[model samples]
Each structure stands twice: as structure tokens, then as C-alpha cells.
Target chain A: MIQLIAYLIIIVLTIIFLIKMIPRKLKKSPPYTCGEPMKFEKPETVFYRTLSNILGLKKLQKLSTGNLNDYLLMIFICFMLLLIVLVMV
Target chain B: MLAPYAVPLLICTAFALPVFKNEKLIKAIAILAIFLSLSFVLSSSIEVFNSGTKVFAVSGFKAPFGIVMVLDKFSSTVASLILFLSLMIAAFSSKLVKERVKEFYTLLLLGIVGSLGIVITGDIFNMFVFTEIMNIATYALIGFTAKKEGLEASFKYLIIGSVSAVLMLLAISLLYSHVGTLNMADIISRIDTNDIYLKTIFIMLILSFCVKIAVFPFYVWKPDVISGSLEPVAAFFIGVMTTTTVYVIIRIFYTILGIYYSTWFSIIAIVTMIVGSFLALLQKDIKRILAYGSISQLGYIFLAFSTGLAFQGMYHLVNNAIIEVLLFLSIGTMLMHKKMMEKISMYAFLLGALSLIGIPPLSAFFSKFFIITGLLEKNLFIYAIISGLISIVTLLYYMKIYFMLKQGEKKIYWPIIILIIAVLLLSFVPVWLQIFKGVEVDLLARNEYVSEVLRP
Candidate 1:
């Protein structure tokens, strides 16, 4: 359907634009060693990374004024859809 | 000829999206069109309410021959709710929406126009078209910002919405095959819907509508979309759109489906409330909390409708519209503050949360009482218990929020407005019993409402 094609085109183009624009807005730096970009030539494994001392798992859990509103809102709205499914049943 | 003006007007305005290059002219036109559309809604709804039903043959075609726009008590009731709230929302937008004003207002009008069309049209195919219109507007509004969270919420909504729309279209297609027509009344009355596929279509519609209303399970998208938006926009939909969609569900289920046969609906209503309340308790985000709160509140709509108390159901619906407007508006107002905004909003949030949990004298408490009593009167014991337990859970979570906010020194006069809601719903009970003739009997519902939506 034409509508389906339009939807695909719009979504694809938007995603492409987002990928290009967002990274351009950020400063490029050699990625940090902990989060270093894995080379395509050599495959990376979780066990390998742990043994290689590349990533610090505990470092990710920094103390901050956590804002959970956005995530919680998503769950709440999804619940609405579930309610609808129940109603339809 | 005149029957389709609402949808046509919206389409025309939307078509100009490429022309105006901005939404200003279209915004002005939208306001004018709504005022014009309100007249039609008022006139036709009034006629239907008084005479029972009014049928307009679209372009002079009759029944099976051509599209018919029928105005029944249910249709008119919802039309009044949608238009009057829309008018108020438009007025609210004068202050609320400033950035991207043209596009925002156009989308707002488009959504309203779609809902209006859905309420007024008697054709199933027409309903599908309007659903698309309404759904598109919501998607645009939710995705108005490209923030990561905003886009994520919209993406989630887009996926669920696509599924529901597909199911709805399939159901409509199936109905068309069976009846060889898309007119609602004709299909219901002429065809033997006892077929298994009839059940399938019913399930599909109920699924679609539940998503629209943001009831339990399907409600996950509402908190994100509503709370994730900028404050004023959140207020607009939180205050109006979600409630309007619930009204849409009521109309579609009871009137369109003519589903007076089963208590299965009551069961679903109970589930939405229980799940909603439990979820609300676990939420940390103020908006997500409110979103869950709304889902729990809608539980009452289902409870009342299943009890076969139509007036009671309508009463709860109207009460919610008022409460949400006040609560969200206060939130919007508090957010407008500079230094004390964070603290003040926390307090306002408490007021809203407390009211939602049925704190005494809050509109929610009294309205909730009416629902419980009404259900008990109908001997729906299990439903009343489930609904009441959910209320208790609501009370617990709301109290928690209230204490948390009270811990802060900076406070606004949130109680002054909170008390206002209590008094309003309290007055409704006396007014309903005719114990107080303070206002005209006709305005018993409208007077309690702070919003300018006059059903008459």
C-alpha cells in the first residue's frame, strides 16, 4: 500500500538523518579505553573484555539525581494499551 | 451535504499545511471552524437528546443506499463532551501553546476534528478514517520533539498504534464482507452476528478502543507520551484527550456495539483498576504516577457502565474531565514559576495525587463513592470490591506523595484549589438529590465543572 511505503520512507529517512546529525553535534574524540570501539577486524567477547581489563562495570553506576520519570511514563502508557486489550476481549 | 463539514474542514486545513508554510492562518481557521462545528454539535445533539435520534442522509441518500449520519443520545452526549472540552482546550492553548504555534494548533484541531467525526459518523468505514486522523495527530504531537526519550515514547506508541489500526481495519473489512455495507446500524440489525467472526470483530474493536482509552495493559504508552511532552501540552492531553478517548470507548462499546448482554466488560474494568493502582504505587516519575492514576480512575468508568447505570457512568466521566483539567492546569501553572517551580509543582502534584486517590471532599472521592454505591445497587459485588481495593491502594500511594511534598518548605496555595474540587463534587451529590436548588436543575453537572464546556 502507498501508505505503507510512505511510512517506511519517512522512518528510514528520519533515522538516517538522526544518525548523521546527532553524532555531528557531539565532539569527536578517540573513544575511551573502557568504551573503546571494537575493531571490525577482531571480534570482541564479554569474557575477553573482562579478562583484558577493558570495561569497568562498577564505574557505570555513578551516583546522580536519577530521573526515572521518562522511563516510568512509557510503562504507564503501555499499561493503557493493555487495558484496551482487556476491554476488547 | 452539511453532515460532513467537520471532517472536510479539518482535511481542508490540513491540506493547507504545505501552503501556509506556517500554521497561523490555519490556526485562526481552525478556531472559527470549531466554533462553527460547535453549533452543529449543539443543534444536532440537542435535537437528538430531545427527540431520541435524528438521521441525516448524507447527500440525500437513505440507509443502505447512502451514508447516514445518525445522532443518538450516546453520540450527542460524546459530541458535547468532545466539542466543549475542545473549545476550552483551544482557549487554554491561547496561553499554553506558543512555540511552533501553527503546527501545534493545526494538529490539535486535526485531532479534535477526528474525534468529532468518530463520534458523529454512523459509518464504520468513516470511523476507521477518523481513527487514522486522530491517531496521526497524536503521533505528531508526541513526536513533536526529537529528544531521545520523546522519540522513544513516540516510537513505542507508533508500534502499538500500528498493530491496533491494522486489526481495526481488518475487522472493518470483515464486517463489510458480511453485510456488504459499512453502516453501523444496518450491519448490527440485518446481519446475524452470532457467527464466530462476530466475536473476532468484537475482540478487535475492544482491543483498539482499550488502547485509545489507555486502560490497564494498553496504558503503558500514556504515561510516557503524556508526561514526556512539554508541560502545557501534557496538560492539554492529560486534562482532555485521554478522558475524551475514554468517552469514545463508552460510545463505541455501549452504543455502537449495543453490548448490554455481558458482565465480561465488568471483569475487564476491574482488572484495569487493579493493575493501574498497583502500577501507580511503584512509579517514581510524577507524570508516570499521574498516568497510572488516570488508568485507575478509568476503572470507575468501566465499573459504572458494567452496572448498567448509564447516568452514573456519564457522571463519573464528566467528573474526571473537571478534575484532570484542574489538576493538570495547576501543574502547568506551577511549572511556570522560576525559582520555586520545583517545590510548588511537587505540592500541586500531591494535591492531584491525593484527589485521584479519592481523598474526601475531593471530586474524585464523591464521584468514586457514587460509582461504588451505584455498582452495589446493581449487585455487582466482586467489581465493587476490586474497585474499592484499588481505591485503597490509590490512597496509599497518594498519601506517600503528599508527605514527600509537605516535607518541602516552599508551597503554593494548592489546597485552596484542591478544596475547590472537593466542594464541587460534594455539591453535585446534594444537587443530584435535589436537596439544593441553588442552581438550575439542568446545570447540576456543568456548574460543578470549572471548565467552560456547557453541555446545553
Candidate 2:
């Protein structure tokens, strides 16, 4: 445990020192939209949509649509599943 | 000696808070009430640790007849932890909660009183009552703002929570019919684990608690609930509320039933872990992400318990509660001071996120390490590996929040600072002290608990 703490402190200090030692300069760049205000969707919306699609969670996400009926149905299914498992065991 | 007074003191204070018209006084009285209760809990914990289990039979009525509050090492530790967090949240909310001051403080204290009762009560029926008390207060707190979204979320929670309550009541009734007593110690002596009826009853009870803890399939209400509630209130829900429910599972499975290590239960926990983590990754809202993250952490605790790693589970319970509270309160600070997000808020969130991801020398790291090692020892290599991979997913979601934070101001939030220190100090706990030794032993020693509570 002592060794672990020592290593943690060392790692943190090393990162801080490395960051401080690195030299960098800030440069202003033109807007990527060519001076037009970009019309784009919220990044989180697009990211979540794509990820959900890739993971095939669209059905699961739809089921959890915050509807009262959907919530009750899920509860009912879970209860039945629990009952089945316990009885079998 | 003061163990029995903790819940009633909070209850009386909660009722009395509304009489005072001054909001600052109301907040002060609420904080004072929690502080007094916390002191009582801490003193009782010291006594219990020094001696053994202490049982307080209500109104001088003995066990199997009247409700009793049992203060073993496990209950004392958990109760103290809950009260401490409640005290922190009470202080934090003093600044955040501007409207309905009296109602907010009253409901917060009442909710905390219910959680305290759940942790300390010896009667199964009494646990159910406290669970309702906590849930009702939680529902009110969630809808305290009375905004459309808040009311909608509270209504959904109420619907699902009522279903859980009915299931718990049904289980309690079945158990009473079988064993003829609601006293947990007495039921332990009478219950036949192999009996199918009793098994069904236990399953009902466990399923109800799983919903309360927002395990997968029943976790749909959580994100909305967290997103809708006031941030400090959300912190209280994620930190104290779910931890207390997990404690109920521990007390029931380990002590009342004396049945440990269920493969089906472990499978449920694993599924909850995987599903919650993945769903968290796909969330856009910070509160929703933390809600799902909390669900995944609950899965870790359940899995630890099902695998017979009671100590590891309890340790992780404490660590997870602290980390969640830290993160939520920091986010609350950021939301409050949006124009200038404090540097302290950023550091607090980052530290909490790192700790949640099980970074080295953090408290959660040790708990996860012990749990994975225990799983490996049980030849559950797949479970161990999945648990490890879930940590990476945890990192991803937390980083999503990290990048969203805009830090500028040098102002400090004392609560977040205190919590950050608490998280750092927690990592030093196991090595520097043996606080959990008695709790770990007491959890597995079902016969000892029974004999203590049933002693004339």
C-alpha cells in the first residue's frame, strides 16, 4: 500500500512536470466554416444516435422511452424472470 | 445507547422545521439536526465496535413482539456513513435550494430518517415501512421544483416505486404466513431455506430491492429522476438512497436468510453491470450518465455480495457513495456558477472521475481489486474480466463530462473541497486502520447476529 501511494504521487508529479516543461504557442485560426456560422446538430445527439445504432440498442432504448407503460412492463418482466429463476434454483 | 434516538430526532426536527418562517434558520436547524444525529450515530458506533451488537426494543417491548433497532458493527458503520453524507448534502443544499426551503429541508431530513431506520431496524415489516417513508420523501424531493419535467419524472418514479412497494409487502406477508413473525432474528431461526415458498418470498424481496437500487430492466426511471431533481437532492438519492437499499439486500441475504452465493443473482448483477455501462456510454445528459454509472456501480456491489465477497462489497459501497456525491455536488456547483466554473469544481470532478475509474491508490481501486481477486479465486474468470472492462467504460463516460466542463474562476466550494479530501483520505483507510474488520466478520456471522438480537 505504501509503495502504491508512492507510485501514485510520483506519477502525478511527473505528469505535472512534463506538462510544465512542454513549450507551446497559441495561434488564432480562421473558422473552419469559411466565415459562415455553422449550422450543425448538437454533437452529443449525433454521437449518441450513432453509438446506439452501432450497438443495436435502438430497440432497448425505445423500450426505455420513459413512458409509464414501458416502465411497468419492464418491471413485470423482471419480476417474472426473478420468480422463474428462484423457483428453478 | 443513543442509537435508537437517531431516527426519531431527525423525524421530530423534520416536523418542526416547517414552523419556523425564516429560511436560514430552517437550514441551520436541518443541518444541526443531521449533525446531532450523526454525532449520536458515531458515538453508538464506537460503543458497538468496542463491545458487540446492541439491540434497542421499541417502547420496552422485546423482539418477536415489537419493532427493534439493532446496532451491530455493520448497521452502525452504514448508518454513520449515511448520516455523514446527509450532513454534507444538507450543508450543500443550504446554498443551492432557494425555494420551498422548509419543504426541502423537511423532506431531506425525513428521507434521511427513513434510510437510518432501514439500516438499523430488526423487523422485516419495519424495513418495508422505512423503505416507503424514504421513497415518498424521495418522490416529493424529486418533484420539489414542480416544473413539468420534475413532476413527470416524479410521477414515473411513484408508479414504479409503488409496484416495488407492493411486491415487498407481498413478500413480507408471505414470510409472516410462513414463519409467523416479522422479526428478522426470529425469522432466521424459523426459516427453512430449502422450502420453495420461502425461496419465492426471498426472490420477491430481492426483486423489490433491485428496483429500489435501479438495477437493469427496472432502471428506466432513474435517469429522468436524477435529471429532474435538484442537484444536491440528486446527490442524496444516488449516494444515500441506493446505498441504504443495497444494505437491505446485504442484511437480508447474509443475516436473515443465511443463503450466500447464488449463481442466478450473480448473472443478474453481471447483466446490470454490462447494460448500465453501455447505456451510460450512449447518454447525452450528465445526470443521466451518472445515473447509469450509479446503476453499474450497484451491479458491482451486488456481484461482490453474490460471490461471497461481503467485505469488498461493503467497501465499494462506501467508496461509490463518496465518489458519486463528490461528482454530483461538483456538477451542482458548476451549474450554479455557470458564468465562471470554479477551478475547484473542475479538480473535484476530475478526482472523483479518476477515483470512480479505479485509478491506483484511490479507495475504489482497492475495493474493485479485492472484488476481482475474489471473483478470480472463485474460478469466475469471465465475471472478473467483465468487471475490469466496465471500468474502462466508466472512464469514457466520466471523460465526456470532463471535456464539457469550462474552468475559469478561482472561487472555491468548500463542500466539494471537503469531499475531495474525503476521497483522498479514503484511499488511506484500509492500510492505516482496520475499521471494516468487525463489519466483515459480523456480516458472515449470522448465528452471532441471531443470538444477539434474540437474547432475552
Candidate 3:
């Protein structure tokens, strides 16, 4: 049962990542843009501004081409570790 | 006798090659070492095929407790092919490297040693050690040119490959903890299929090797590595490097694990095929196109495995090695000159491309036919159909490259002519003889493999 659940979770996460990545790949987003369209403007949201602050302007541009999702990545990693521990235990 | 000498001879020569300052002598020794190794493996392969499995008990120790080498039909066949291909690549590219010739040839020979070790080793831990050796050599080889793209590609491959290696080591540790054995045959004898621990270990090992073989999610580094490396180096990577990884996969899942993860392998194979062919279709650069095409060809090998066609899969594996080496070498020659390809080179490329498409009369067709037939016999119509359809996609991309080729009147090189002749001979062999018919009997006899290793 646990194996099935683990497999399903991986499949779901992979599907979600693929959903997010296909568009960026199709558009061939430039580096540091995270798949988001570039425009001349200050940060529109606190999320964007704080992220840009942390990563710097250049990396923010690369990340915005929309490849990285910090929250999901953390969740996925945690889930994998949990699965490994569960299997081992 | 030759089985025991091949690896040591290659390793000694590899280390010795870099000690010499004479470029011409270094080149000669490198070629001579590879050619000699090729002959050694060839003689050993014939002996093994004619008689039975040959075991080389290392340092007066037998299997289970000692490091042993088993030259069965499978290992001998693949190892011989790899050594032969290494010799060809070495001879073909001897003059291509203008700088660091010694380091280049040294790493090349060492890499071949690693690959040969992986195929012949009976212990799981020895296999991992060899995997690392091969990977490290490859990492250096890819970055040898010191070009920006080569370094980036090498770095990327290193990151992914190191993680996979760690995973494999962990899997080995887990298996040892449970079975108290590092010998693959002994582990198989002790494995408990019902235990979740064993199941997890199985999954871990499969995933690790899957990464090595670049199945789906783990394939991100493949295109970059192939495109970034020098053409002959890329040929070596594509042709023999990937073949050894798949060999390990087969040895583990089919031989040691005794567990069939056919569904997962099938899913991975189908996805890899689709993604590879589609990406190949989209590429404009010649190397990138061939890289993606090679990825697609890997998918076909796994697809055969998924259908329980181990022999047929190996047949495809052999075919892919020959065809990819031919295609990469020919295209590489053309690209090196930056001129229109000679008519013979074009014909060679066409032969490779057509063979890859599974055109009848080519040796590749028989392998694919057998795989599809096996699938159909098992009522796996969907898989059979999917694989069949994927061949068309394979042909389409190959045709795109075919049309892109610029015809020239220059003469093809002698080495390339030899490769073309090799392909032709391989293609015609299946027509007149049932030489490979024994592979099925050899591969599926699990009990035979176990007894051969355990025998005093």
C-alpha cells in the first residue's frame, strides 16, 4: 500500500512539473526569466520582490523563466526522504 | 586464459601510456594495446560461446567470498564488441587530438578497462567500483578538450552520475545487510522476494541503473554530454558506454534480482522513445540530432527488455552499438572537415540510418522483429504497436538528417570503409545463419548461471 502511494505521489509531482515546464520549453524562455514574460517594471508582488532580493536580479531573471518552484521542490524532497525511511523502517 | 589477461593488460598499458613523452610511441602503444585487448576478448568470446561459461577466480579466491570474473556468452560477446569499437575509435582519432595526446589515450584505455570490468565482475560491489571508474574516466574524457561546452557537459554528467553511483552503493549496502553476500549469484540465492526490504533494494538498484542508462528523468545529461564531447568520444560514449549500463541492468533485474519490473521498464521505455525521437526531430545541429536519435535507440533496447525478450534485446543492443558507431564516426568525419560529405560517407550514414530504422536485410531488423514477435506472442499488442510506430518516428528524423547531408566527391577514409564493411557483414549474417539463436537459451537459463558461478 505504501509503495503504491509513493509511486502515485511521484507520478503526480512529475506530472505537475511537466505541466509547468512544457510551456517554458515551448517558448524557449531566456535565462533568469523563470518562463515569465519580461517587461520594464518594478516587482509587482511581494513574493517576486523578496525572491529577487534573496537570489539577486540576475538569478531572479533566470528563475522566472519559470523552471524552479522552491516550495514544490522542498515538498518533493521531503516526500522522497519520508518514503525511503518508511521503506527502510 | 585470455579472459584473465585482457583487463590487467589494458590497465597496465593505460597507466604506462601517460608516462612516456613520445607522442608517436604513445599513439602506437595505445593502438597496439587496444588491438591486443580486442583480440584477447575475441578469442575468449569464441571459447566461451563454443564451450560454456568461463570463470576467472581472482587471487586464488572463488566466488561469494572472493572476487571472480565470469565470461559467459553475454559478457564475452558485449566485451569483445566494446574492445573492438575502442580499437577502431583509437585508430580513427589518433591524429585528431593536437594537445594532451597522452592523457587522452590514457583515459580512453582506462575507460575501456572499466567497462570490461563491469561486464565480467561477479560481485555487486566490484560492479559499483567499476561503474565509478568508468564514470570518472568518462568525466575526464568529456572535459579533455577543455572547451567551455565540454566542461559544462562534463560537470553536469558528473553531478548526475555521482548521485547515481551513490544510490547504487547504498543499494549494495542494503543488499549486503540482508543477504550477507556481495557476490551476485549468492545474493540471488538468498534474496527474499516477499520482503519489503528486498523489494525496496530492488527498486533502488533498478532506479540507479536506470539513471546510468538514461531512462526518462535521468536523461537530462545525455544530450549535453553527447553534443559537447568530440565526435569520436561521443561515439564511444553512445556506442559502448550505454551498452555496459544496460548490460548491468539486465544482469541485475534478470539475473540477480529474479524480479521482473516489466511494467515500469515498459513505461520508461515508451516515454524515452517518444521524447527522444520528438526532440531529435526538433534539433538542427547534426550532433544533437544524432544524440537524440541515440537516446531513442536506447528506448528500443529497454522496450525489448520490457517484453521479456532478453535475447532479442541484447541483439538490439549489439546492433545499436555497431550502427551508432558507424553513424557517429561518419557524421563526425564530415563535421570535422566542415565540407560536404564524400559519397561513401553518405552511403555509410544512409546504411546506419536505415539500419536504425529497422529496414529489412539489416541486422537490426531481425532483432526488432524478434522483440515485436515476442511481444505479440505474449499478447502485448499495445507495446508491440507502440514500438512499431516509434520506428516510423525514428525513420523520419533520420531522413531529416539524410536530406540535410551535403554530397561531395571526396574519398571516404579506410577506417570508415572497414566499419561499413563490418555493418554489412553483420547484416548478412542473420540472413544465412541462426548464429544468435543460442542467445535465448544462454540468457534465460538462470539455474545454469547460478551453478556455473557456484561450481568448484
Each candidate's iRMS in angstroms?
13.1, 2.1, 11.8
Q: Is candidate 1 or candidate 2 better by DockQ?
A: 2
Q: Model 1, range B106-135, lDDT digits (tens) per residue?
A: 777778767777766768788888878877
Taking chain A of model 1 alone, its TM-score versus the true chain A equals: 0.31
**Which candidate, 1 or 3, would have the higher DockQ against the true structure?**
3
**Candidate 1 lDDT, A1-81, residue by residue in tens:** 999999999999999999897565444532355787633321123333342244332232121112344434444455455
Residue B153 lDDT in candidate 3 = 73
Best by TM-score: 2
DockQ of candidate 1, scored on C-alphas against the true complex (2 decimals): 0.03
As for lDDT, the candidate ahead, 1 or 2, is 2
lDDT score of residue B443 within candidate 3: 69
Show model 2 residue runs off by greater than 4 Å.
Answer: A1-53, B1-19, B429-433
Per-residue CA lDDT of model 3 for B38-111, tens digit only, reads: 78888877888799998878897888788889888878878888887887788777746768887888788878
**What are the lDDT figures for the candidates, one per model?**
0.61, 0.85, 0.77
Give me the candidate number with maximum DockQ. Answer: 2
Q: Over the stretch B1-456, how does candidate 2's per-residue lDDT look in tens digits? A: 444446445554655644688889888878888888888888888899999999988898998787888999899988988988888898999988898888898888889878998998999998999999999999999999899988988898898899999999999998898889999999989988889888888888988988887887678878888998888989999999998999998888899888679888898899899888888877778888899899899899999999888888888999999899998998888667763468788888888889889999888898899899999999999999999999998887887777677877676767788898889988986542377766888888999988988888
Q: Residue A51: error of model 1 in Å? A: 41
- Ten contiguous residues with the weakest lDDT in model 2 chain B: B1-10
